[model samples]
Every structure is written in structure tokens, then in C-alpha cells.
Target chain A: MQLQAEEYELQFSILVKRLGSWLSGQTGVAKAYVTLRDSQLLFLVVTKSTKYDSDFEDALSDLDIELANDPDLRDITLSVLSIPNVPSDSLSSFMHPTTNFEIQRGGNDG
Target chain B: MAETTVKDRLRLVERNHDALVALIEDARNPHDEWVATIAFYKAIQLVEALLAKRHGSVSTSHFRRLERLRVHHKDIYKQFRPLYNASMVARYLCLPDEPGSTSVAYFSSFSDYIGDAKAAIINGRLIQLEALVEKGLGEPFTKTRV
Candidate 1:
């Protein structure tokens, strides 16, 4: 029973929103977004700290466990970058995609 | 930006592989953190090379690379995830031991913190990945003199 492309996209969007809400509450995560690059889905997390501290690692480990346990998102790949790692132009590029969902600092939905 | 060819990616793979070998063979000090990091980057290059050769384009990011592997090459993905996690631990969490503190610790001994055993495990995983890459690319991946 293969899902239609539209149905799959809808499901993906719903899941991303739920994940974004969960990520917004996570400590040390300043922002999180999902973007399609080269036809592949990417979950990019931007941490508040410039360094990879214990808090960031804890949040990352928790996210990994959560993603692994989720049936739908277990197979999805995720990337975590500190604020310093993201280039200025790339941030805009990440936000350009319509499918992208960003949860900014202070839990502001973007 | 110019698109990277398979040759360019493989060249980067070779360079990282050479650096891994050099770091492992260095006699002065044992820095397992660096060893883990280099091994992971080498694996990254190998994956990128495979993607470029097979799909005609490399991944735009780390997660994209892993996603490409997960969808197209599950075996490589399985081998890569542990290496990725290990490197993250080595780079960020495995801190140096402090003196005479009797608190519960994640890693107690200096060896436990990215030690020889951990380094050996990471190396073994890297070799497994290289074998897979060689099978896919039909070329030798390890070019270290030692």
C-alpha cells in the first residue's frame, strides 16, 4: 500500500510540526528546521552555545533516542550545528524552502 | 560553486585516510579524540565519493549524506551511525579526568575516555566502511604506506 505523493507530503509536514514543537522545548537548542536539499530531507538543529557543551550533547542524545524510537522518523537523518558553524547566507537559504519549519529561541514558531 | 567530481571526493578521501594513518602511527602522544574525528571524516568523504559516483551529485550537508545512505545504501548507514556517535562523544563529552573527585563519572580512567580500546573499535568500523566503499567504487580505498 504505497502512499500518494501528496499524502506523504502532508504526513511529513504534520510530523515536522510536531517535531518542531518538541525541539522548541529542548534546552540548548536555539533553532531547528527541516529542509529539502537535493531532494533529500534534512533536520537541521542550531544550538545556542558556540561550543558543543554537555547540555547540547544531552539534548542531542535525547533527540537521537526520540527519533530512533519513532516509527516514522527513525530512518530520517539529522544534523546538529552550533551557531558558529552555520554561515550567514546558508541560514537564509535554509529558511527559503516552503516545507521548512523553524522553531526559534524562546519557543517562537517560525 | 563548481560541482565536485568523484575524483575530487576520492582525493579528499585519500587525504583523510593518510592523515588517519599518520595520527595513529604518531609515537609522541596518544590523542584518541583526534583519531575518532579523523576516522569519521574519512568515512564522510568515502560516502560523498560514492554518492557523487552513483547519483552524479554529492550531499549538501552531513544529514543529507546520511539520508542518502539510509535510502540508497542501508549497509553503509548502519556502519556509519556508530562511528558518528562515537566521534561526537570523543570530541565533546569524553573530558579529561580531574584529580581526586569521588563523583559518579561517565568515564573513570584516562584510558576509558577515548582510549586504545575505543580507538581500536573506531578503526575497525572505519575498515568495514572502507571495504564497503571499495566494493562500491571498485577501487582500493586505503593507500597508506604503513
Candidate 2:
């Protein structure tokens, strides 16, 4: 069944919160920012890992699969970013400060 | 880091593509991980060339490049995502089991692991991506050798 607009929005919010909490618990994830752009949900993840690092890529692939498997998120155009690849200043113009997820104490050893 | 020109990126595309072709044709060993990794880099260069042509600059990071593709070139993004994931698996997760251990006991089945078949699949995807990028750029990729 197709979700109504309001119901979809509610689901999106819940999913974002759940994803944020889940990401906080992941290894190498420091902070994550959520934002909507061009009708796509973007997660800007800050990590100590460099681009193309094996563990980082593994985590990303896993996340991609997880999102794809979720019925609520399957149809949504979603993109996850590892922040090192994108400068924070460049993203700040579009990503609001309030969207930052609450990060845990010690998981940034990528 | 200095910004690379479209010409430079395309040159890199050719270099990586030729290297991929050479690796695939080697008779001694399949070199699955190297094949997959090279194919991914070839795809990256193709996307970077397109990005340079369209946006006047290439992305400095992999995710940023992916974001550009996702936002501006959805078709390419669809093709590129699988290539990226496959390369990740080939490079990181695909490991040889103990001498007497069954492959089924590991993270992946033997047939599903990064082997000749998976490398071929990655190569096919890279070719498809190359065609798409060439169409978008209105230029044929120069292949020194196939």
C-alpha cells in the first residue's frame, strides 16, 4: 500500500532518527548530518577513514544494502557521504546546523 | 591538489582501461581483486571526465563524485553504485579460506566470491559505464589496446 504524504513524512523522520542512532554506534563514524536536497535524502557522515579505505567502503556498502532492504526507504533517492571527501564549508551552505546527529563517545578510529 | 583537466582525466581513463584490459587477458592468474579495482578506477575516471566537462571541475572525493553523479547523472549513478560495491567486496571482504575449510563456512560462497566470474561482471559494468559517459560527453574513448 502506498503511504500518504503525511505518513511518509512521519516515517522518514522516524527512519532518520533510527539511522542516526544506528550510525552513532558504528565504528569509525564520528558525526553525521541529515539534509534534504534535490528531493534526495543525504547523510553526510564524518569519519576518520580516508576515501577508498577498505573498512570505510565496507561500511558504506553495508549501509547501502541495509537502506535498499528497508521497504520504507527503498523508493527514496538517498545518498550517504563520507565528509572527508567533501569539505564541511562547502556543505554548510545547504546543511543546517540542527541536523547534526548526536555522536557517541569513542568510535572514530578508522 | 591541482585540478585536472578533462583531457587529463580522459587520459587517465584510457590508462586505467588499458591496464584493466591487460589484467583481464593475463593467462597466468585471473587477479580478481586487481581486475575489479582497476575497473572501478576506470569508471571513476570516466565520471571525472564527465564532471569536468559539465561542472568545470572534478570532485576531490569519491562520495562527492558519487553525489554529483546521483544528483546530476542518475543513469550513471545507477550503474556506478554496483561497480563501487563490487569493487569494495573484491578488495576487502573477499578472502581465502583455510586450506581445508569449505568456502560455504566463510563470509561468501566460493562461486560468489571475487573470482574470474565476478571480475568479468565488473568489467562488463565498466564497459557499460564507459559507453554511457561517452554518450554524455559526445566523445569516443581512445583505446590504445583492447
The two-chain DockQ for each candidate, comma-separated, is 0.06, 0.05
TM-score of every candidate: 0.55, 0.54
CA deviation > 4 Å runs, candidate 2:
A1-12, A16-110, B1-4, B94-105, B108-123, B143-146
In candidate 2, list every pair of residues with a backbone clash: none
**Candidate 1 per-residue C-alpha lDDT over B1-146 given as tens digits, one digit per residue, 9 for 90 to 100:** 11357778778888987887778788896666777788889888888888877788889877667657766786676566656755765654422333244332223322354346333535446777777877887655664332
Best TM-score among the predictions, by candidate number: 1
Q: How good is the docking of model 1, by CAPRI class?
A: incorrect
- Poorest 10 consecutive residues by lDDT, candidate 1 chain B: B102-111
Best by lDDT: 2
Those runs of model 1 whose alpha carbons end farther than 4 Å from true positions after fitting are A1-110, B1-4, B94-103, B108-111, B117-119, B143-146
Q: lDDT tens string, model 2, B1-146?
A: 22457778888888987888788789797776677778888888889888888788889776567757766786676567757755654554423333244322233322344344433445445666777888888656864233
**Model 2 score (lDDT):** 0.61
